[model samples]
Target: MISKISSQRTRCKSWLLGGLFCAVACVAQSQAAGVTWSSQYQDRLFDSGGGVLDTQFSFEVGIFLPGFTPTASNVDLWESNWRTLDRAYDPTPEDPNDGDPEGWNVPEQFFVGYYQIEAGGYSSSPDADPLYAFPGGAQAYLWVYDSKSLDAPREWALLTDGITADNLADAWVVPDADAGSLEWYLEDLDVVIYGGGNDLQGPGGYTLDPVVFSLQTHSVAVPVPEPGSALLVGLTLGLAALLRRRGLSAARG
Candidate 1:
């Protein structure tokens, strides 16, 4: 009985210690980054749009790590943003007008996703039918293709944006030339993430937050914070650590 009890106690301690570290680290990191994770929300939630509560959407977004500070040598990381969400989705025409004067049409230049998904019952003449890409067509299914990268032209993550034209969108994610040689998101001299998706399925048709990245200090437990936010977090955490030590010592006595 004693052996069994001791084993159970050991497992309990292991779980408690592991859980605490993980929870603390995750919470701290999220706070430090202040990332706005991509998620489906009712258009009405933050809607300045008409009162429609459109809830369905597939979305992706990314923020490059602040200054590309951590693990700068990662080529794939350099090519892509620091964090991204390219959820798979496809738009199908289910309305009476398959794809014409009344669906969703934003110009090709505005999309954040690098690729596009053509909706069901697509029209050949995109110029005339500038509205819904698909009208009353078929059930939605996800399909993807690489909008860029001719060398490795494979289907990237599929998106749920409604029907769109096949032509590629104009590039907008230009590199900041002033960010020094280390910065690669160059608009003029560089490449990658050139264009984006536009005409969002949601009501507002645009992001509610600005894109930004937080620095990471992996060697230290505390995630690096934005310029003014770090000092307060550090002081509070230090005080908590001191109290924890005191409690542990008292328990031993």
Candidate 2:
């Protein structure tokens, strides 16, 4: 009789312990999926660049989608806005004090910025679009630049044909590595919905946007839980130890 009672208690303990772990796992997954890609974001009143109404941002690495970049560079690598260095832009030696413009021969200017979209990062749009409407069957475009090239190639390489909208569009980036360290950036995103054109530019075709997506002053800033993850880890461990102790007591009795 004692043995049977002990076995039953052990089973009960096992069930409870399993449930605790399961609860934690489920909570973590949901948090991950529902969590906004940007650690913080803000809504723009007037769409200036790429007609973006909302811009997303995050300091953490996973803010972007998977496969976007197996490895990503920090924010310092963002190369956002710059015109080509040409005759019109060339500096004249009119001022003898002016330094040498020879160094300006590089292909493009570099700025490191995270991914962003016009609409808010959600299945349902909470932010209003003042400039353009978000159309159906919008296509995704990936732009990757070579930071180490001698000319710093003006061209951006394509990463994919088309990507589905899972509410986390514009959540990827391409890293520019230099001397085994990441230098500049190219964003691998899927938020720009190009509907006017056919092909991938159509509802679900693959094509690159000829235009650039610019950031505004009103972008959303969604802060992530800095302490919650660690707390959850502690709770999980505590519960596990408690359950184990109870099981041992039951077995001995």
Candidate 3:
């Protein structure tokens, strides 16, 4: 009988110790893990149509990818002061009969994204189509081809739609155009092919483009207790429990 009781006591003690050790270890480990990331691309703003006019081109950083899959969820309206330098600016029959322009110019660019989701929209041009290049259409996907790593010609996605030569300029916001301090997320990171129409083909059929921008990666340090510390904590709790049980038994006797 004594042997049996002793064995039970020993087992209880071990369990208590183990529990304590686990708790401690968990705390330690949680404090030890660390993470790092690359720099963030700044907002890019430049001119085109006249020539390969590019200046500030960069990407927004720290956006959670898995979360930003694609949806009308976060719609935002963008306005641009652009003019259709192309005199032959004609829309396809399928194109919505919104209105005819005397000539495409000032306050002509308007774009929407995450609009339905967030209930917001903007326009650079007063006379622009709401559905010009919506993500839900052929101009749905946005590609950020890593010019340095991937092949240029095949590694891009249709970021935004209404992205015509004229429309592209509509979205173009010069540094001076930034009303108040403006903050923009990098939407498209691609080589601005001077004349590459909506097709967006590469120069030499390479994987990536000369233009490359990236979002800043944000990280937080995770605390991970050392294995040894965890073990010790668990052991202490287990032992304490076992001892408490023994005391109760002794009182009953």
Q: 84 in model 3: Cα distance from truth in Å?
A: 42
Error of 2 at 74 (Å): 15
102-191 in candidate 3: lDDT tens per residue?
211112221121111001122223232433321211122222221212212212111332343533122222222112232222333232
**Rank order (by TM-score, best first):** 2, 3, 1
Q: What is the lDDT of residue 251 in candidate 3?
A: 100
Model with the higher TM-score, candidate 1 or 3: 3
lDDT of 1 by residue, 1-253 (tens): 9999999999999999999999988754333111111222211111122222121222333234345522312323333433331222225424422332222211211112222212332222322233433322222212112221324322222222232233132122221212111111111111112111122231112223222211000111122346667887888899999999999999999
Per-candidate Cα lDDT values, in order, are 0.29, 0.29, 0.28
lDDT for 81 (candidate 1): 32
TM-scores of all models?
A: 0.18, 0.21, 0.19
Worst 10 residues of 1 by lDDT: 212-221
Ranking under lDDT, best-scoring first?
2, 1, 3
Instruction: Please write out the lDDT profile of model 2 over residues 31-73, one tens digit for every residue.
Output: 3112122111221111222232211111112112322331112
**Candidate 1: residue 190 Cα off by (Å):** 21
